[model samples]
Target: MVFDAPPATASHSWMPSSPCGPACIEPIDEIGTARTLARLAGVIGLVLSFPVLTAATPKARREHMQRRYARTALRCLGLRLRIVDHRHEPVDGFAAPDTGVLVVAGHIGWADVLALAAVQPVGFVARADMVDWPVLGTLAKLTRVIPIERARLRELPGVVDRIARRLADGQRVAVFPEGTTWCGRAYGSLRPALFQAAIDTATPVQPVRLRYLDGDGNPCTVPAFVGTDTFGDSARRVLRSKGMTVEIVLEPRQWPGTDRRDLARRCADAVRGTDPSRHGLLDTEWIAAGSTRVQDPSVGERGPIRRTVMATRW
Candidate 1:
């Protein structure tokens, strides 16, 4: 499960690039205090509902509640979400899904977790240190998110084992394989380490690209929780922005037996929005990430997102 010829930095790596794409903007538009209270109320409600949710006998009932709560919670935060599915095989919304599927999404800000939770009712793989955060930490523990000690290389396998078990049991597990956040302008490689978990469990890998757009339809710059960016600063940025739209572009799923390196490459390319023909990244580099911004999608009315490129087969 070595993800690269070299290796990735620790999970707590803090690299931030100021997005200079046409889609990025300045001037945070402050939100009213009432909206913030609404989100707080939503969080409180979730905390109160946990006992009943956990005690529910039916798994499907629990999942239904999770999705409902996530969506409502995002609304209270004044964020709108739109999901564009490009999967050849669409998943049944409320079906009791089989195990062995993993979601590898681009990491941008703390909101990535919240957004994905609303879109897909699945547990997440987060940093081990997050378990100490006040409210968020409690939610992650209650929701059964697997935590990885980013700096401890020896511990990755153990974390992956937990992920494998979750997948083997028919649950979808999400991971931010970038190992950290990036400028929304371009995507970095998917860490190869986690891909091993999928291969071992015979799990399918689904790639997703998450981006935040402002009221004017530009890349929302304020929400990125990157290097040295404090939680209060990021939260204020999101609250001050007039409108924040989270676009989730779901790519095709790579089935079991597909080479782990190949899976990492395609996912990296999709997240970067690179044309496959370009072969821009080396295989070694695909698993080991580096930061750089390559294009501006907002310059002109861009066409369909390459990540969500459609297919006729799974």
Candidate 2:
């Protein structure tokens, strides 16, 4: 299968509900088993190379491999990633500063996480139940993954504290504040409450937008709502679905000084652009200016696909 790069143009036409061209899904059912083995291998690799990663003050070597692991895992799963422009680039012999970015990205398809992992060493906030999975659980721990108890709202403060602690340690924390995933055609409004930790820590919230394209680079199908779609099923659909290309554009970070609600609004506007309707569906309050609380359409729509798989930088 071939993948096409997104154009230089920023704007794109929203795809209609018609069936996308020829489905190019491949039979990647073997990826699940392959990925499990790869994750185990990566763990072994990390153990053997521990000395090299720690030889430097920042362990740049080890972190570099972690990014590579993320990308490779995604590629192995048949996911193609395309990072648009970076937020910052190295300058004057200095590397890009890690301000403990609180990365707030649009949650669309389950594959979206893979695309995000392809970029940097990120700390993912996942559901607590995912910890019991196979190799994915082990990898998440290695990546300093912070698991949250979605069923109990009271435990969230502690989870936020942990996330803040990681941020203080200079780790980029990624959260799907929409709290759920959907197709590219629709999105749950930004949940400003999820930003409480970043707000408290005064960390910059870096917003990112993701769009999936077909092998021809056209919008094929919106990768959305994985819980409703089992991983095995989703993987099969994706493999046979066609070579999907994901477009990820990172926006400027929103400083902590701004109101959390305003920050969320700005981010929603940034990701959604002028058309709130393009995303197949939007919360009623989401389209209203300055509303940060987004309505989640699938709060209780959990299914069997509860595991959080890791992806190397693709």
Candidate 3:
């Protein structure tokens, strides 16, 4: 099945764009055809059983099921998830019930939503058309994602208000502030619009750095759904790739001050780890204030955390 790309909005000139495309992708080792077919079957089975698994389950249990489903889905697609926590007090996988936090990340592709949910089941600010997609549409509804219409600029405030309400009620909500997807090798700037919700509710902003890596631990752009590529195109590429790892670096949380632009820029800087112009893998040092030891599960140990030089308003 083919999904048509959204038409370019003539009036929405601020929509983010990226120069990375299929050419930016590096060929990686692929699983055998039989294995690929088996993985595809696994994915189909999971998608078909999702509703039955989630149906009538309590909120906590449903979230547990969602996390398992997301991890299983990634495994079915031959992707491994590596989470790096840099927070002073590391909450279990981005879920904090007492208070709400706005999770922001560098947009990669459709799989990004799955990766975040795998860590902690959180509602997403997604494109309005995502609710109409095939099996994913059902998943979107189950998660109660907040849909945003890019073409309708006037409706943005309403979307922001909805997100603010969710945050105010102490519900974790994730959003890709870049406003568009980019190849894993490069990313776009974080638009300040969504940051308003965090500022409005005085919620801390969680900046997550997401990247795809090959078996050799180099950046991989095979999963990017950028340019004119359709969802099917990206999916086929991912299904064929082997030893693909989704590295999620949960950076320090920035408290929302009175400036959304500053918050957006600080979050972007944290995600990018350096100048946005630089390509290739970023050597991000997990920096945080205080003496709390940060843990790196990938390395299987805890280490001293360096103080972050980024100015914090609160």
Candidate 4:
């Protein structure tokens, strides 16, 4: 199913002011056609394999198939995924190969879902409206996804509780605390309310950043699945193009120690440091946590992040 349009200011397709400028219209149209065919083929394949996956025990085969499906879909779109700075990335503290986890990450684009799924057997919290989408909705449910209504924030506790139970039983889950997708420049202040489970169980939170590089190696506007971005057009644009690199950057897991808000702040701070931008995306107050200045003898880099954002939240 095609996603809705992203917000106007956040649009990925920018029209040049000069009318005579080269048009990407033709390429976009062609890509859209290819995307349509791939989506149909994907749906058919999923239906055909359903019974076989259901019958398989231990499900390693089924899970690997899911990863393959995601990989194939991305490849058909001409999108390449690159992982960076993961050498020292720590494993999820409570994540057993068969168990579940609460993976809290930054939301930037639709690619994130596919990229994350390609790594492990996991689930996501999607909007209730997504359940109405044609093939995509059905496939999402098949992946053990749980849908939530955006209007009903009060039901969050019950929803998260259900997810926690799944995690306790060994199913990894991902949540975007920004509550929405955005350009990968900075992290939005996380909603403390959704972080209750970490506080309650001291569960580890995985912080990730998604960066989309253009053909020229510049940061491109990622296609968010929601908001005003046109899903069909965006899907076509991404699928047909080559030279784009989407990175699924996974960082070490953060353990619960302080207050809920403080934990959220630290997670956000750690994620912000990963931005390719020279200045970290964190607020000034956040940067003030330690000796904010130093005559650096080092080659090139901001002085160490001595102050901790977690301390300020209190």
Question: Quick one: best TM-score, which candidate?
Answer: 3
Worst 10 residues of 1 by lDDT: 1-10
Q: When superposed on Cα atoms, how far off is each prediction in RMSD?
A: 9.4, 11.3, 10.1, 10.4
Q: How high is the lDDT of residue 184 in model 1?
A: 60
What does the lDDT read for residue 196 in candidate 2?
76
Which tens-of-lDDT digit does each residue in 1-314 have in candidate 3?
A: 22655322324444444444455566799888999899989988998898888886786677777888999999999999999998888588785665798999988888999999998989999988887766567788888999988767778899999999999999899999767676676565677888999999999988998988899998888988765677677777999999999999999999999989888889988988863443332235422211112222223232332222322221
Q: Write the per-residue lDDT of candidate 1 for residues 1-314, one digit (tens) a residue.
A: 11111112333323222222324334546677787676667766776776677687487577667777777767766789888887776475312366557888887776788788887678889876565654566678777889876666677779878988888888888898866565464445566778777888887788887788878887665666554455555655665466778888887777647577777777776666652211112222221124333333444454432232111111
Tell me which of candidates 2 and 4 scores higher on lDDT.
Answer: 2
Off by over 4 Å in 2: 1-58, 86-98, 278-314
lDDT score for residue 1 of model 2: 15
Candidate 4 lands at a TM-score of 0.70
- Compared with the true structure, all predictions reach lDDT values of 0.63, 0.56, 0.77, 0.55
Q: Which ten residues in a row have the lowest lDDT in candidate 4?
A: 15-24
Q: Which should have the higher TM-score, number 1 or number 2?
A: 1
**Weakest 10 consecutive residues of candidate 3 by summed lDDT:** 288-297
Q: Comparing candidate 3 with candidate 4, which one achieves the higher TM-score?
A: 3
Query: Can you give the TM-score per candidate against the true fold?
Result: 0.76, 0.67, 0.84, 0.70
Q: Give the runs in model 3 whose Cα sits over 4 Å from its true position.
A: 6-11, 275-314
Q: Rank the candidates by TM-score, best first.
A: 3, 1, 4, 2
- lDDT by residue (1-314, candidate 2, tens digit) is 11211111112121111111112121222335555555446544654553454455365456566667667666654567887764564421111446577888876555665577777767798756444544344556566678865545566678878878877777788887765454555455676666777888888777887777766776545354333344444544554343657787876667767476777888887777765533222223222212222222344332221222222110
